[model samples]
Target: MLADFESKHSLYFDFAGARPLQFVNPPQQLEVKAGQTARLLCLFTGSPPIVSCWIRNKEQIVDGPELWTENTDQSSSLVIAEAKPQHTGYYTIVVRDRKSSAQHTLTLSVIERPEPPASCPVISCVTASSLVLTWSGPCYDGGSAILGYAVELKEQGHTEAGDWREVTDLCTSTSYRVCAGLRHQGEYCFRVRAFNKVGASDPGPVSPVVRMEQRVSAKPQAGEAPKRPTCVTMDSSNKVKDHYIMQEKLGVGKFGQVFKLTHKVTGQVCAGKFYKGRRSKEREAARKEIELMNYLHHPKLVQCLAAYDHKPEMVMVMEFIAGGELFERIVDDNFEHTEPASVHYMQQILEGVAYMHEQSIIHLDLKPENIVCVDTTGTSIKIIDFGLAQRLDANTPLMVMQGTPEFVAPEVISYEPVCLATDMWSIGVICYILLSGESPFQGNSDTETLALVTAAQWEFDEESFDEITDEAKDFISCLLNKDTRRRMCCKEALAHPWMAAFDSEDLATTKCLSKEKMKRFLARQKWKKAGKAMLALKRMALLSKGDSCSSPTSPGEKSPLSPEAKHALKSLEQKMQGPPHFTQCLEDQTAVEGSSVSLSCHLTGYPDPEVVWLRGEEPLEESSAVQIEYEEDGRCNLVLAKVSMEDANVYTCRATNNHGETFCSAKLAVKQ
Candidate 1:
């Protein structure tokens, strides 16, 4: 029996020598913002059956949702999806084997901007010339010392509340006196925010509105009264009609109606977007958009001149882009569509995207319809429609199924965590269409298209890409990579060979791409738009009826579950059915490098869940070395052929069915 065991388990025991547990890579001190993800890795190589666990402080860590540990015979990783101040501490990875044991430790620091001032300001010594107010330090200094306070004032009944004027810079004193720019008899509200090395915190609660008044020079005698002011100035209002005169309607978009406007003072033509309603949510969304516009400043981005509370609607005034849509220019009979022109537009787009990314903003919805030309020449462009834009931070990964079907990244379709690379994938699809006049992953319907996107199934048509340059193809490939880590960032893309070729004045390298197919693509898009409009109208009619059976049953007609409706319904069902559960969980496997290994599992879930393989936090796509198979009996297998040392790690199978997600993981130990 001993001889048989030794012969059968020879893969685990090294006959050559007794290998000792040792650290191949060790963890190091790490620092991250409070709301960011933090990862600590500890790698070791030794004999088989190495046991490892993570320890925080003196307690062993048990893997869970917010914080989890992945371990193999040779490696261990502690992942904090969203690091909090409490998570800042020393962490240890303890490894043990039959013959040896080892451990590694590291420190993690989670910092954030200071919290708001402790309480609202106390009003005192109110006069026309100066207003003195005092405040306390923040309740929390965000893991750092509070440097000072910043004050902002907003005059009541003048401009928008968000338009607060800064009073002073880094006022070390808790109390501040506002004197400059003070208006006599003006009503104003003041707010304060604390600052630290991490950054400035959100403003504290606003103080009660204060009314400024003139002071009496001396005590009044019996029956004596102070004289009234001789003149009074009315506060300026920020009504849309007061600032601009609305002209002809420019266009209609997903969130609002765009109209041409003339500035009352300068007589300059601009565009105003009037939101559909003044509901609280809609108003809040509009304000968020305005805030982003105020924060981001770039030539390639549509500049928000001003915003006004237009009664039932909120109107945002922006620069008038008269060049029409980029698609229109491509199909225009008189317009020239050359490779150089495409390069020019892409460069500008990258510049805009880079600016947004630098600000940690992701434009979730980036498509041709959102890109507009500045003039008929089509040389200048601006990216618009930021309704879906979001700021990415350390708190947690953003998971949203948004963006146009054909242009969305695979991660978007799979409801995976969206990162900066999500926008890169859209850019890739746009580039593909621009050069070939084709939508690379378009299918017969949106659902089919989304499925294609999830699979990363796309190929260049021979006819359309015949004239496209190899450099351009490579650029698109890098952007469309299934793994976000492998995708090119805006900065890298700007320096790509394809983009670099156009850095010089030489337009000689430019090749003219035939726009004939582009015209047809544009026509198809218009038809689809008209169809969508009809569908929206039909939906409204059905909604008015309030009948569950109002769905059209005619052949070729859409069902009640429109693509958007289906997603919502699926979400609801997911909550009802719960997450996927593994009936037969995966088991650990050991294999030598350059050998084949297979891990299998059985999971049960409703609505037919799709599996996403992950090697640590990064997802794995099907390739020659990795093959994923789904059996009819609900069994799934991940086969790794010719596995390398890099393939050694914790592999996870995450099953998601739109509404719910479940995951199981096991380690793969590869021996050299």
Candidate 2:
């Protein structure tokens, strides 16, 4: 067979001198500053007519503006011009022939510190014993999260550098209250410094001197009558209840609850999203979503009818679609799903996405659950859920770390700048699942799923894609490319061969696709969603109850701890005795290669704390080789079945409850 193939196509191969591809000089990992150029060169030995290609995030690279490639028979070079933070990721060089292939992978890190605060700190409140300071965050985060702020204080009339002292090394929030060392009748100046993974930024401008006195008051002007205090009230008639009659609950979301509603005047039925929290921050976030939805107008997109601000709560009226979600229809026994059907849905999704892109909008969350049908027949489709949608312009680039792990784009997982291609990646995943009835990147846990996405580890399984056409697979591959630059845009995807053949009268288009795998996928998604929703609601309730621990003792039966303990015991005393605290923290350990290892810690908190294990910044989830155990008596353990060099890192155990949260970290060393 080999001789026959070589004889037939002798021009593309050298059968006599062919050698397996080998990398003589593989590319090395790189660490470069943003805006700097980076180049990766690889030299290899292979048969004649060897082909070399560059890939990043599973996407093949070609000669382009930002990224360009140069290749010869046995060598390749990938040059990244004016590399930005978004370009930080893994890059691979592959040299291959008809019979053999060699590849090398390397990571590129872009380092930069966040900018200082936008403006000088301001004094929000001044009291006799404490001073409250607030400042705006930096305009640019330098491609990483702004972990916290550092507050520094300098007493007035002090010129020496030693006069300035640190108020707090880490202030997670933008506002900080200085009550511990502040003294009455003292004057001080404050400045803030923002920090991220890279390091702390330059200190912002110093604030105006704040004079703390025993009392602050202003006297009325002489010969002038004192003005009466003005009062404002909300009109009861303006409440959402007065305009709409809320009906049965439809669904619950992270930030709000959806309900079926009917307009009182028009008697038109619609869906209303009522924010779950009455706090000002939650209401503001709800208002932002509603405003964005109302501003966007399209047939394929859900429309926001009206918005109502009823005091501390916000309600948004949305178009009510009778048909269920996209996946629900796919899993329905009565629904006839075929290659053409999947294409039909994907075309509609592409059209909606194209419109959003034209309007500078990117729907960060574009999963099967967010796409719904117009009616039971499933002819028309509407893209719902704008909770994570963002608008990006020429000047503003958004970096976010929030999305469904299974469908998130590689850049999102890396916290890189998001582009229109980000949504296209999710669209590709959706298309893959629509035709195959299986998710390409789903794993046993979120951590694993995210790892799969970052690596772009997916393939066309024979079992799932046996009947799938090459055109369909090509379409999905174009969108799922890890390199956002190479990924297809909405218009390009809509113009793909598979989508163009939506109405074709062919076997591949007419054949019914099996739904067995899809049904299972739907069931698994529902189960996971249920668990997450329950946890979120529980956490919300706990947080809303304030930062006080519930006592373990029942009323009138306390033997005694202290008056402070008795006072801390609120209404729900049976749930807990006191706030959570750590009895012991994790310690550094050493283990041999391929050996089982366990890290144990002791925790004691009222109302049982929720524990999370993390390796570096990445979370560790329960898997075949990983197991987590906790006991009623505050015993916690993390077990690893087979340890490897990759397991060597700083491991952290974070425990959280309504009362407070604490964490401890230790290093793990693995030896061969």
Candidate 3:
């Protein structure tokens, strides 16, 4: 029984090997343009089961939505419905089974769609009462008469089916204006459809609903203070005051006052800021601040709960923090053990600051006072007061000097092009205060502090920071660099060894310290092997082309013999020979206006050469006007229909196979 099984396997292998292991179709000669469809056929036969693949160039076109297939006992065909110029390349049919395999190559050519004489442009609503429409015109169509266009309108809110209503007719111009006189509070929808002699196509998608309401005016009410500062309140006389007198006063400031209040309905504790006498400018700023806060949703940032215009009062409600500001926790004498408590707290602050920087937001006023520690455990910190914050794009230059005197970066003080790196500088100062229990640089007055920062003179007392790890010192030193260019960025700072304390306990200890340790550890060894292999290949290629008189001395001197090398050599030789030839035959080929045309190339070559067609330097497959056909004798014929001025270019036919490759060219002229 074993002997019989062995004989059967041998016979199966012989049959598979004997059958031609080759792609049956001319995979290279077909062409199609973008937005056009092309079909590819894979023909093969075998006694044992065979699997097939359609590959573009050499890469397999895996089964996907764009690639569909139909299989039969004799052949399988792949249909690509919308071939794009990106699809232009050499295609191959690969057939294989356990015993043997075969492949055939074909080149694909894609053409550009003809420019339409009149385009049906996209339409949209610019405002509630007006609709804006745009379109592109065709390049050439005998200047066909654009009698007019048909505008359609339909309301999405209509309960029953609604019929489209055509409005004013449009001329050859590419734009249209539509005005609505509907209900002031009602939303209306509109769309535009184009028409010509051929007939009208489907209408475009409906435009966004436009309302007919007047723009709401947001102005400060009378009896309000001029500066309605965020998180604070003020009286009509421009002094700190609370509109809701019952809520306990938490703090007072120049522009407003902060009140700890409870929601009348929800009974939830919240902080309220009321404007004393709202100036128009201050009211506008308050309005914008509310809009900005409404869109922001982050865990580390204080949430703006609500905002309202209470006639004579402009109020902003916010989440109340119980733990008070980081400033109080670090500076208050009662919190003497703040150092150990601040280690974890400082980490959370850095995390929140890093998040803001990632969002392209610069908390220009980043200081201990602005950072509120909400959790009673003192482990959480929330960045507050977006009033001074700005969404900074890379191109924007710092135009205004902002932030506290001590924590502000030198560039910010200098009114230079400060970026997110400025925030990093502030974070560094905060870190120093948290670790050393004192500010890194200080003075009795703002003027003295500015002088100290400008001079860049500060002492780092090693004794005072004995408990702080050297890693932390190095991290701070890198971040505190006065030169903005040299300052450590948020991402780089986050990746520093000191910041990796949570990843490994030993990382925070000095025992693992070594000069150039991270550099040597992260270096790759695989790159060395890759370099050696590349050098060896280059040496072999050079020796192969050496003078015949020179004798081959070493085994390495001999050309490396591999399956891939042999296959490449065979392929190169085949491409040198041209395609097979056959008699040229034509029935009727003519160029017509608003129509398509075809051109054919018939040829013959030995060893069945592969066939491909090209117009100018580009392959021509799926062109609205071009079609290719392959005959039994290996001859290819190209067909170009409704040929236009763009089609007037030299065309070529190329054929390549295992034995050789060749090509032929012809010119197509469009008659006036």
Candidate 4:
């Protein structure tokens, strides 16, 4: 059983007055002429004294060449010599004691001469069919008030004789816009002069001649003409033809034609793309090419200098690479003797591909023809033809089949959802071609190539590639894995032992090659270790079961008991007892002096009981002195601080929350 009760009480306090205080009279306003001396003062009175200060703008005034200050029991003053506008604004006087402070505000105004207005220069000019005039204003002279300004303009090659227009109503703070109607297709020069109330200054130099073109309006007959559909024109005499200035024609492909062009201005060379305009789809393809070039920024990717959108014609300017495509270098030129350089170049290509994937950009087309050496040095490879590039956001679902048939992943060929893994698969095919100089999977026709991709059927003869390193083969195998989940990503492929060989010659010749072979042989061994780790985790989870097991706690482990655990235990115990009830306080007391005091008691029952507070033997109510604080779940607190003798008896606390109730007592002691 538990006893419950509540009570209330009142608390009060008083303080004794100290010694007599003093009053100070602060200055109302302090006026100081420029280059003159001025002093600020404050007066006060009191016994034993007080500290005073000269405060300016709520901050203490310090002693300097311009500002000198002194303080005493009678008054405090701050002296200022050669006071300027910076010395203007408000000042203050402050007096303070151990317990309180007094302050006053004083306005300090300094008289000085007005600053001169600065001269303004012409900032910019815009030419329309009409305007051949210019305007000017001031920057900031000496801050003097500007009354107004004057304007003037004259044609070029004309002597000191010309009409000078004067507009007196001009604001100094802003630039002036001058518009003078002039003949179209004619060049005219102009100059502007500025003036202030003080006087007019010299005129600024004349501006260069501005030639405005005449505006033409469309006639009814011209508007009736049919609008041309944007297309890629093959004729070399078009608008872009003059810009590109084809020097020589490169090899043509099913996709488009590339031509070498020399920029007339920079005298630099570039490649111009001229897509075949036989179909409407070709026009759409032209836009995709420009979009791809604008999004990709990498050293290894082809740089798009400019794109022309002439109706019924489109052209893309790209960096001219004389080294040609990798396919031509390896197959057409027979570069087996240059195998090392070729392999290194292929590694750079893979690096670019990896970077594209990391940026969530997919280069759907990956082939040797798209990979070209960008410079005569043959040190850089460029990935071109981004007509099929697509961005993949983090949440984008993998779907829709895309890319060339032969390089497409198995999922993509089967019309299933394909992700960046599909790109990796294409890169694997590219790597295979670069190392072996032969397509890993090819057919007599496009239909056959796609069939092979769908079936995931590709032939790789170790005998035919005996000269090829095992490390290279392992990397390709990881990327071409049939399962997307197990397939090696672009990042993982770049970190493979085969790619690592590019960094170390010794590793390339020995360790990486051996490691690749060992990996193939010990594939099952790694899986066995993974299996053991999983089993161990499962057994540990099963062994830890009961609530009172008192499992071995690791260092710094917090209490394993949860709030739900305590709730469950309390519920069970309360069922063993009966309905809950409140408890009464046996006694209560308060302290007259001190900072903190405590109240305590014991709670007993089948279920762990809670404690609450009360002033007297009645149910406790909340007030400033008595507080019913709570701690961890199911634990109640009765905290009383700043104890006076009034708080010196037993305090009652009733704790019950669906659990059986219990009463607790607290004894408080007040210190003198």
Candidate 5:
């Protein structure tokens, strides 16, 4: 029976040693999440069954609950279950047979999952149609940090019950709203859950049924905020030029400048906001802007078509509004704003604001500047700038007062609880200026203006309002009321008599703004535009000078490899040779401190190789002073900006491909 088995399975034996016993294949590098089973296998030639053992860090491993061993005549495997970080590192398998013995090594990496949230999230407040939820972080990190949280809602009464629908929006903030897709007066239960890399925990204990119409006033509870994704950083490798043709910069926005970009295929124009997260708040603010624009859709709002999370920064592409700011047309060189036109603008503004409020979004910054004109006709208005926006219950006291001072409400100045009425006050200020061409709360300086605003000091300028009607004055007064509760919200303001006359024949023909008023408005706007531009320029200068470690290549620039390097690589494929081999290996080099130098390597081999310039195993950072130059012939050079003692290291130029890899290294010395 044994002789018959040997005759049938002769492929496993090396008869007469036709080929020397050798490793046909060996285990490769492995990566796995913690708690998962990891198995490494190695194949050998000519074996009845080789005695094999697994070793980590030179220590022989033993079989147990977390580890097991398996072997066949030709191959062997070492298995590790419930792998942990300690299991990570270099591991080797030694195999011995009657003919010969072989040893193979590989690397294993186990990633640890983050722990669940330290504490459960709490419900902050609820309004007629919205429910707000907030949470703090988990006590232990587990291994990975918290990525984001999900707010789930379910109706209480059910036999089998439906699945929980997580709020599907881009926001990663501790505070988020569940107003959409909800019935106005229905009773719904909510649960807040947090998740990390490994998986999610069971939803926190469910909450009592919340009626949609229930009104509650509350502030953000004090707690340890979760480690949310506040910043999305980037490097020189992130580029947008491949698909976009950047045109003129529109202007600086709340977080960064808005650029005019045209698509490569469609040739369509759009405004793109490219932001670098220098501060955590800046990153959070940018994230919120994207989240708000992602789900909002209205004729009165600038549409965000798509967003690109291009590492190093986030790029938001929005529908381009061509005409520019509303003030631009309202203060045109030959501007004439008819009362009907002003009414048209205001109607659109209120409709936009009404829609925003319906969606539980508070436009904290509302002013003539934030409103944009769709075209030169002043027919369409779009609201822009949402830097200070937030989602809150209708009556919640927002202690943080942030908005244009001239337009801020008295409640804001007193550091009291603020609500949607704060936005109404700003709108009122905008309307007052639009009708009278004189700021109702204008003062000598910001301090005096703020003081006057706090006192709610303002009156109709007799000369400016001589021709204005009482209905318009009444509409403005109701919104400017210091008692926020008495103030007319967008819905009520849109129903005023003056607004009712917006479509009348006579009113349509009467120009609301005179030539003298427009000229002054235009001058002030020009100054503001100039001031904003200067500020943006200064910011750009600072960003460029801030990172001195390495100067980065312009993301827009093309590769700078030399033609010779290109030729070498192309010729290598045609010429018969082994894997990439270095022709001129790097040599020891010395440089004077503060002096510049370049190190070059000449290489040739089959299948063009990708060469990485490195200091030890660390890749180099491209900067203005230090650059890596390449040629088609596989020649690579490292150019130093200014060599310093700190720059001394063992420099290496490693080239690799499918077949094999070759490297040439040398010591770099910088003298005093």
Candidate 6:
């Protein structure tokens, strides 16, 4: 029979029908920013679906750093996270089975940073009301072409102080004939800067101050009035849309939503706060914030690295200061930083503010929420949110009400001119909260809060202050003084005696808080979560009994729980000051087809461990046959719902933490 089949070709029937056709649909072309996630999707259809293998620029991929693969009944995917430029190039996916195979290919391009321009502007001509500027391209294009240039002007002898004010719209060409807005007789200086799709380049040297000379109206000099370059007022990063990849959204407000952003090439994480330009007021705030961050850089300040303008939406890629908000530490019951620790944190705050003031940038909004711990140690702090920051001179009058009501200075509430002193006032309030964990001006209502801030209606509560020191009180009073003249600047605040002691020897062992206070804080934080969990369970129990929720499913509906569900909801209520133990074991369980069985045990331990249910030495994450869940006090349940023969196995309950591990195992026999 084999010899006869080998001899015939055209006589063969439709065996295995269509030869198990496999079709692959990879993207024709894909573009992703560097440092973002890249996903390659491949799908197939046949009697027994497709098995796939992925290749990049010709090398087969495997489970390794930055690469992963997942497959389902009919689809499969390759995911590369924190993708880099080296990951770019040709990619191919081959889908095959016993009878047939097919392949799909595509090109991936990862956008990266362009080089900053190298040329400084040349002053070609100058007149009473205009200046003509010309420039050459950069040393490198930073992987992209130069898109535009920026022109700014400032007075010759101001405060080393005044920020450079952009005078032209982003010019599309190398030269811009700066027309209009020049002082007729006043001395002035000008500078030129360039930008590309990636980001802005440093500005070239400023032109020497020149007294404007009148130019009589005459026949235009040949090529004098060249075509004006189409200039846009927005930064190049804002105009060009593709440089950065938007990742997860973090929050939303009337200002706009915030997101976690990653720089495609560098893989740096940033907070992208989107300020909706849907309203003029909001847009102006966004622009001001960008302008402030553009020039300011300091260790204590949250750096605004880049800005993107997705029209009607503006995004700022800012520093991802890791430790979370200062308020969290304030509320943490376990946070028991003594006077020495508290003083160290305060000193850093003042140091950061000093840097900001030195740059002539005033953070109009200063509060616990706006400040964050930059490092895990929680000692290093960073100031965030320049949306309310302004480049104000001491005499610049503030006109609007901004900042948290609780932290706003008296000068802000009165609509008086805000200066560095205004921020110092906020620091005083922060100092108060830091020491005693109490708000100095917070009230029950917005009206009351504003009133308290305006009137400087705050005092050191005697009870809370007894544990605080006189030097600390003096430092707070000096900064919080309603009088702006005596208000301590960042330098003076840093020099305060209370802050000075932090630098003395033996500060760390000096204790952050009084012994009793430290213990109370730790106890407060540890038990709060456990207590809340207990309260929720009680409410759930009462609701379930009242509603008769234990009834079986009527029909065509999925049951809320399996018959074997170990609803040991009451087990975790007891506090565990002892080592974790197995109160209940798996204990040979028997269940019928389509029924559910649950196995659970109560664990007692200090500091909960990661609890897992395993089969032999293999830990189970989750599956259609089994699931794992736990309660606050360390009681965990392993539920095997919809029991089938495949569910038969020995299950183990294991708890592991920094301390050690404890486990209990039992068997389950499922009958079909």
What would the TM-score be for candidate 6 when compared with the true structure?
A: 0.42
TM-score, every prediction: 0.50, 0.48, 0.40, 0.39, 0.45, 0.42
lDDT of 2 by residue, 478-551 (tens): 88888785687775687788886756477454778898999889988886763453343334334323422454
| Candidate No. with top TM-score | 1
Per-residue lDDT tens digits of candidate 4, residues 1-672? 124231122111111133333454446777666677777777765422246555553355667877887776567787887777667666655554323345555677665433322222222234454431223233322122234444555554456564544433363322344454555566555544444333555555655555555322111121121111111113333356555467788756555787888765456777787777557898787777676554344567776666666666677777777787665554432333233554576568766776565345677778666888765444577888886777664455655444555566777554456677777888888776655545665665455555566556776767546776777777777777776645666546656787655455543343211123323323422233323433432332233223115665553332333233333333333333433343333344445586665554333232333344555555555668657543322234566656677666656565553445555565555657
Output the better candidate (1/5) by lDDT: 1
lDDT of predicted model 6: 0.63
Candidates 1 and 3 compared by TM-score, better number: 1
Instruction: Please give, for residues 1-672, the per-residue lDDT of candidate 3 as tens digits.
Output: 433433342110123223443444444467554577878776765432345555553344656798776665357677887987667555655555333455655656565532332334343333455545544333221112233356666655774435656665454344455565445566656655545444443555555555545322112233232221122222233321232233788876444677886644345677876655367776766666665553344567787665657555676777888887765554444443433354466667666666555435677777666788886555577887776676565445664455566677766544467777888888888777656645666665455555466555576666557666777788788778876645776656766777655453432332321113112212321122323433433343344336223864652122232343334434434433443444463333335544555566555443445455666776655545666665432345676666677777777776554556556676666665
lDDT per residue, candidate 5, 1-672, as tens digits? 433532442111112333344567465678778889988887876433245666664456767887888877577788987788677666766655444445666778676654434334444356667766544444333334355566777765643446667765343555567768778887777665556666665566566676777754332122211111121222234345655688998887557788998877667777788887677777777778877763345578877655555555777667788888887677666666766677778888988887666445788889787899887764778998776777765345566546665677777666667776788999999888888777787665555666677778899989887877787888898899886756777767888887887564775467555646645755664444433433433343344345323676653333333333333333323333347778899999999999998898886654455566677666775779778776533467889978889889999887775678888999999899
Arrange candidates, best TM-score first. Answer: 1, 2, 5, 6, 3, 4
Better by TM-score, candidate 5 or 3: 5
Clashing pairs in 1: 35-394, 35-395, 36-394
| Alpha carbon lDDT at 184, candidate 6 | 78
Model 5 has an lDDT value of 0.66
Looking at model 2, residue 513 earns an lDDT score of 83
Q: After superposition, how far is residue 540 of candidate 5 from its true place, in Å?
A: 30
Q: Against the hidden true structure, what lDDT does model 4 obtain? A: 0.54
Residue 303 lDDT in candidate 1: 75
The lDDT of each candidate is 0.73, 0.73, 0.55, 0.54, 0.66, 0.63
RMSD of 6: 29.8
| TM-score-better candidate, 1 vs 4 | 1
